[model samples]
Target: MLSKFVAAAALAGAVVTAPAAAFDKPQTTYKVFQFPQDRIPRIDGEFSDWDMVPESYVVGQDQMTDQDGGHHNPDKTLNIRVKVGWVKGLNRLYFLYEAKDDYWDFSLPGLHNDTFEVVVDADLTGGPLIDVQHQDIWKPEWVGQRASKTDPRVPGSLTHWYSHGVQAQNYHIMTPHKDKDWAMAWGSPTWIKNFPFANAAQSYKFTPGQSGTYRLEFYITPFDHADPEGPERSVESKLREDALIALGWIVIDYDDVKTDAKNGFWSLSTQRPMFGLASDLPLFKLMPIENAKLEARWSWKVVDMDRRLVAFHDDSVGKATGWHWDFGDGTSSTEQHPIHAFAKPGSFVTILDVTGPDGTSRRSKVWDVQLR
Candidate 1:
């Protein structure tokens, strides 16, 4: 374990000394395979909408074997595979945990029960990790938390966010389960004095699929914790385009009997201390634009009192050499800039299509035009 400050200084140096191309490379390498969500899934234990979410990555951990071919873990059924997805619209990251188990044991006294931990590095651009170990120090960094199945005094589920060894935030009934409906009604900042810390605000839903496989979906909303007047910050601001982020996953199993002194544990994870020098961790990048939008421009002048012809321009986001315009009057043009005349029209919808960066298919946008 690197001393937190030393890690912070190293991170700061890396961010400052790093060259360009940090933005463009991740756009292709860590390209997030996300989908548009017409309706964000309710944080209930239902996962029907998750099927449409494109799977971005997967990491699986099964039981191990020794040199003698002996079973490393007796609980072979405790093995787990995690599937993850991302949706920029909701500013949420989803996860699915497929654990092979006959029964469910979530009654938690400690780390002895079935549980999962997600560690995220929100400082995609790289910086000194801030307020991680203690509230007094603010260095701008990443965070991690362990979300357990259930706790008696803590209602539905218990999630603990800590820095170093200090507890920063605690949430109860926030993690939804397959058997129960647990929802976070509000951004419960009161639970932690230093609210809005990086990776602080989060929501999750868990559902059991098939006989022994189960899935979990969750999201995080990082905010400015120093603000006394609380207001939710834009998650995109932290997860910037082309920026790199470190994500870590760990799943633990206890296999029945949640007792005072817990035993029987198996675990797996990515390298710890997710936030630091960029080279120190496995990083993922945020795409420049998940989907393309258009910038429509036109030059028109009145030929007479109530008649005019216009030349419409296709000024979309990315670099493009081709354009197709649907004038919405039983007419279309494939020119980069098209000239059209609207005769006797009240309202018309115009569409623009341009190929994306790949130059393979077309990306489109529409605008409503009103002529009087």
Candidate 2:
């Protein structure tokens, strides 16, 4: 499954083509809020400490429809929804990823198995430095996997899934873009092996009301501007309070059936609509430690098209105690999750103010309520 991408890119001369206007940009950048608790969540795969954080962004398949080959819905392999979370403290930056998929097939002799990947800009540059035509993108700084083989121990590569389909792979953490050769890129760097703060864990669950779900909990010691061990980090890599870092993820699904053929291994890249191209990794910005101030964020869904009724969810950061909503009309609401019906449809400004113990912050959006 994974090998097909490397093979395609090897033959194409480049993994990603020049950014074309037709290939619309996906919502790649998201905001990470401060964790409600002072301590980090244990790598136990529970959402106890993460329920309050907002999902920074979501990537749909609209952007990929223009690719030469028809675009694959990146989120469909995982049930079309991937929720991500981030929180930062003085010592490290934490991340949480949740995917909805029905099957959990790790059985593998080939590379086509259920796998999840994450790319973070170790340098926090928002984008890559070697931008030819805005083509070089931030590659995977960390990757996590579960229920895979544990043989042929390597620093960064995974053991064959066939060998240990029921156990976790030894190498969940990986660093990409170190080498041009696909095999060499799997070599783990010394920093990856020696970094004391880098760690990851995964867990699975099957509930009555929900599909089979997988969650990932991990953290990386934020870097400084100084280049660390290899070429992966430059003067740009630094994880600081309010640091804006580029981040993205991919979920590959085998649909409970295992096979070595590309047809069985359907893949999705976070921002790369054209397979696993290096140029399209989306970004997620880190927020400052939670305090009295506000980190206003939200997620919404359309309830009615003609009536113009929309539902908005507030996932604000900081210690907010009060909320005020302006629904574009003279009417307003104090509800955190408000459903508003616009009297007339065109473009209206929706505003929200979240007040906390320390202060108040405002968030506003221009909603274009259209007819169904």
Number of the top lDDT candidate: 2
- Runs in model 2 lying further than 4 Å from the true structure: 1-28, 55-77, 80-91, 124-195, 205-211, 221-236, 256-258, 262-279, 289-372
List runs of model 1 lying over 4 Å from the truth: 1-31, 37-42, 53-56, 62-75, 108-112, 125-212, 223-243, 256-281, 287-372
| lDDT accuracy of residue 98 in candidate 1 | 55
- Write one digit per residue (lDDT tens) for candidate 2, span 270-301: 23432223234443455555443576766667
| Candidate 1 colliding pairs | 129-141, 130-139, 130-140, 130-141
Residue 155 C-alpha lDDT in model 2: 26
- With a 3 Å backbone cut-off (N, CA, C), the pairs that clash in candidate 2 are 123-237
Q: Across residues 1-372, which tens digit of lDDT does each residue of candidate 1 receive?
A: 234563464345232212223321322233344433444544454667556544444455642121111223345455565655555434444455555555455444333334554434344333223233323432222433333454312322333222221111111222223233222212234322231222222233332221255455545443323121234322222333344455443344434453432222332222232222222233454443344443333333333425646666553544565677777677888887666777765566667766645563343333445567
Give all candidate RMSDs, comma-separated: 12.0, 18.7
| Top-scoring candidate (TM-score) | 1
Candidate 2 local accuracy as lDDT? 0.45
Give the Cα lDDT of each candidate: 0.40, 0.45
Model 1 CA lDDT for position 142 = 40
lDDT of 2 at 221: 49
